[model samples]
Target: MNDLLQHYEIAKKNANKYMRKGQLNAYVDALIEMNHYKKLMKAVIAN
Candidate 1:
């Protein structure tokens, strides 16, 4: 769970960085990855 949160934070930062750099594709990928991490975190919390 801790690892998942770390990855989520990293992905969020990467998304912001990519957006600032105008890298649309990379930003979208990072957003998708962030969403995946969020889902996993939710599942962990639910259980």
Candidate 2:
């Protein structure tokens, strides 16, 4: 969880850079997908 959060923070910081260059949408989408995976991990851990 901590590692995932760290990655999220890092990705967020660079997200804007990508957005300005018009290459960030795909990266942003990837981040969202990663978040979903993290949620799934949390759910699995909870069980």
Candidate 3:
């Protein structure tokens, strides 16, 4: 899961770079996905 989070972070960073090229939606999606991942990680750890 840590690895997944790292991958998501990298993807988010890449998406950020393209925000000027019409990737704002992608960036927002990445942010949402990252937040989902955080929630998932919390749930897993609680179990």
- Candidate number with greatest lDDT: 1
In order, the Cα lDDT scores of the candidates are: 1.00, 0.69, 0.75
Off by over 4 Å in 2: 1-22
Candidate 1 error regions (>4 Å): none
Error of 3 at 47 (Å): 1.0
Per TM-score, the best of the predicted structures is: 1
Residues 1-47 of candidate 3 have per-residue lDDT tens digits of: 78767866886776677675677788788778777777877887898
Report RMSD (Å) for each prediction in the order shown. Answer: 0.3, 3.0, 2.2
Encode model 2's per-residue lDDT on 1-47: one tens digit a residue. 67667665666656656677788676677568567757866876798
Q: lDDT for model 3, on a 0 to 1 scale?
A: 0.75
Model 1 / residue 21 / CA error / Å: 0.4
lDDT by residue (tens digit), candidate 1, 1-47:
99999999999999999999999999999999999999999999999
True-structure Cα RMSD, model 1: 0.3
Candidates 1 and 2, the one with greater TM-score = 1
Model 2, CA-based lDDT: 0.69
